[model samples]
Target: MDEEYDVIVLGTGLKECILSGLLSVDGLKVLHMDRNDYYGGESTSLNLVQLWKKFRGSDKPPPQLGSSRDYNVDMIPKFMMANGTLVRVLIHTDVTKYLSFKAVDGSYVFNKGKIHKVPATDMEALKSPLMGIFEKRRARKFFIFVQDYDESDPRTHDGMDLTRVTTRQLIVKYGLDDNTVDFIGHALALHRDDHYLDEPALDTVKRMKLYAESLARFQGGSPYIYPLYGLGELPQAFARLSAVYGGTYMLNKPECKVEFDEEGKVCGVTSEGETARCKKVVCDPSYLPNKVRKVGKVARAICIMSHPIPNTNDSHSVQVILPQKQLGRRSDMYLFCCSYAHCVAPKGKFIAFVSTEAETDQPETELKPGIDLLGPIDEIFFDVYDRYEPVNEPSLDNCFISTSYDPTTHFESTVIDVLNMYNMITGKVVDLSVDLSAASAAEE
Candidate 1:
């Protein structure tokens, strides 16, 4: 217990576990400890009884809801983009060998009081009803431009530099309507709001291109993928990778106390009166509350349903993005659903989640737009949690803290958070440029 380590991770959340794995793979001595007995801290999947107990304050699940073992409900619902950063990480660390994945069935965006499939390719763009005929042609041209864009190829630049141009300018160049821009920015690019429109166009273009590439990866209905059981498998897979690289793990370590020297730099962490010495500490914000502050709040509804989300083309698994413009809200609402086909539920059962950044005191009213889209729900649970970000300087404290997960129902923003934390902890960007295309589980 007195042995020293290069880094000590203090949570079993997806972000912490990934950091532990990456650091261990970098040949650093690592020890990961969690206050809970479970592998995933806040991101663990719950069965029917556990879900009911957590939300309803009882262990009694409805008899009509089927067996408890048939439900693998993710506490923090998200889907992986087939060609996104998380997939690159999985392949870079060879973690896919420890888990299996299947393509999500559909992706749609809400616009102007109707739902429409998000057009990632030119053919889909031409056929999409979200835009008028002229707007569709403009959108297709934009998509073609993005698909052919090459940073190193001057000819593909089209007399415009995305690095300096605002996304608004790029969209105006193609004469796309405001509605078309809304879905492109908020849905396909997965931006939280319209703020990205005023930012540099390069990142937004890259995000849209990634979405198209991911959709093409599986040639499926959507660009996303989910694991066999649920998202809980992800942290465990990373834990195994960390273990294979000699990182030690402990769960149910009560009252994990981060010890600091007189100068306030971290020296070790103590649990059960046994202190494990370390040069630095990596942890989620929950481990060091004093160093973090609430940046925002997330309101979500976990819904158990007998059918898939209505108007989603009967997809067993799907995501629907309700853009803020369509709902007259400040932030978009996300709906995610997976059914028996995804193995996250029993036969004739579906699990869906409606989530968004809380913009008002009444979460139920705020989420009503998304909830109404589910048609009807069997049982529903509502949760609102504060999102925290570290305010302390990691260099001064030798403590790297991960931010709380956001309300978005995709891994793009989550992976960026992880990558930023990795850079801050290791002083180098985590290189994840592995060939993820070859690792896609898509079998045509």
Candidate 2:
């Protein structure tokens, strides 16, 4: 406890753990501490008994749910894109060697009161029932334009400057209907709201390309994947990477209060009256509450089901996006489902989650639209957590804090937050241009 270090990470969440691993690999001495005994802070997965204790305030789970050891329910559930930024980071850091992944079975979007598979490529758009024959042709042209887009190749530009054009303007060129635009923006681009419509089209086009490429990776059903057990495997895998690089970890350490010097820059973290000295401090919003502001609240319902979500082709795992316009809400609603095949639940059982940015105080009522799509739920638990973002500057205080987890069912936003913090901490962008073949090697 007397030794000084380069950086002190104060949470065991996936973001903090990943940073710990990356910094340690960069030859920075890191000391990670968590007040909780668990490896994951807010993102921890719970067994059946622990799940019952959290939601029901009792340790006893129903016998019909099977043994407690068989359940690994994630508190902050999300799926990884098969070829997205996080996978690139996993390959860059070589952390994927510690984990296994399985491709998600479906990615559907709700439009015109029915769910349809998200058609990312031109061929899929032609075969999609979501659009009329003429509309499909227009959509195919739009998809082809996006697929051919290359920043470095003038031949692919087609006289359109994506950086200057709004996403709405780009879509208007194709004359796509409102329904087609809805899935293209929310399902493929994974935007939380229509705000992106007015933003430059460059980011939107890149997101669409990423989606198509991810879908092509496994050629299974969707563009997403999840670990065999649950998301709990993520933080633990990074923690192991950190350990292999000589980072120290301390759990069950209570009262992890950040200590500042007289000039108000981070100097150390004091836990149980022993101050572990470090030049910079990295933590979640909760560790330094005064440095963060409440942005919104997330309302979610976790369900244990005996069957797959209806209308998803009986996929063992799936992601369903309900666009905000369809729900008459300010944000989109997401549904994620995984069954025994993922080893997150017992045989014949499925775990599903419906989450959204809360517009009302009643989460159960707010999430009804997504819950209704589940068909039947053997057991369900409703939860609401406040979202937060940092208000302080790390340059002045040397204290880097991560944002609270959002309600989205994918890790795109989460990884963005992590990468942004990594740049701030290390003063360098994380280069993720590794070979795609390296990503597949992670599963082996």
Candidate 3:
């Protein structure tokens, strides 16, 4: 308990575990501890009994729900992009050895009042029903522009500097209507809001290219993928990687109090009167509450269904994004659905989550639009949790605190935070170019 290390990670959340694993692989001694006796902290997947205990305050689950072990419900559900940063990180660490993945069945976007499949390429854009023939032709041209856009090749730029051009300007040049812009910005680029429309087009173009590339990778309906079980496998897989590289882990550790020196920098973490010394501390917002400030709240509905979401063509697993414009909301609403095909639920059972940043006090009412898309729900649970981010400077205190999980149903924002923290802790940008195409599960 008194041993010193380079860093002491105080939570087993996905963010913390990834940092622990990356730092360990970089040869930095890391000691990871969690107050809970589980691998995924706030992100843990709960079985039937645990899920019941969490929401109903009772350990007894209905027999009709099937075996308790048959359910692995993600507390903060998110999908991984086939060619996104998180996949690159997993490939870089070779942690895919501990995990297997399946391509998400579909990705759809809400337009007007109904869900439509998001077109990933120029051909799909031309064939999409979301736009009229002329609009589709215009959108196809825009998609071709994005697809052929090479930052290194000026010929593809068409004499427009995307870095200086606003996305709105680029869209207007192609005469894309508001509806087409809505899906391109929110569905394909996966932006939370329309703010990106006013920002430089470079980032938006990159996101679109990433989406197209990922879609091309698996030739799936969508660019996203999820593990066979659930996202809870992510932290455990990283923890195993950390262990393989000599990182230590301790679970069920009580009262992990961070101790500071007179100079106001983190020196160690104390548990049960024994202090384990370390030069730097990394943890989630819960571990160091005072250092984090409430940013927002996430309202989500967890639904157990007898069938897949209607209008998604009975996809075994899928992601549906209700862009803010369609619903007159301030942010996008995300719907994630998975079934027994992904091994997260019993046969004939499906798990779906509708989540968004809470704009009002009533979560049920806030998530109704998304819930209405699901035909029927056998069992449903509603939850609202406050989101937080570190208010303190890590360089000043040597404490790198991770922000709370956002309401988005993807790993882009989460991986951004992890990579940012890794840079802060190690003073080096994480190189994620490690080729993962050879890995069996890289795009399963």
Return the clash pairs for model 3, or none: none
Scored by lDDT, the top model is 3
| Model 1 per-residue lDDT tens digits across residues 1-444 | 689999999999999998999999999999999999998888899999989889888999979999999999998999999999998898888888888899999999998777789998888999998888888888888899999998889899899888899998898889888888888998889998899988999999899889999999888999998898899999999999999999999999999999999999999999999999999999999999999999999999999999988888999999999998899989899999998887889999999999999999888998999999999899999999999999999889999998899989899888888889888888888777787765755332
Tens-digit lDDT track for model 3 on 1-444?
A: 789999999989999999999999999999999999998999999999999999999998989989989899999999998889999999889889899998999999988888899998999988888989998888889999999999999999999999999999999899999998899898889999988989999999999999999888888898988998898899999999999999999999998999999989999999988899999999999989999999999999999999989999889999999999899999999999998988898999999999999999999999999999998899999999999999998889999999999999999999999999999999999888878584545454
- Span of 10 residues, lowest total lDDT, candidate 2: 435-444
Candidate 3 TM-score, C-alpha based? 0.99
Backbone atom clashes (below 3 Å) for every candidate: 0, 0, 0
Off by over 4 Å in 1: 442-444
lDDT, residue 148, model 3:
96
- Model 3: worst 10 consecutive residues (lDDT sum): 435-444
Instruction: List the candidates ranked by lDDT, beginning with the highest.
Output: 3, 2, 1
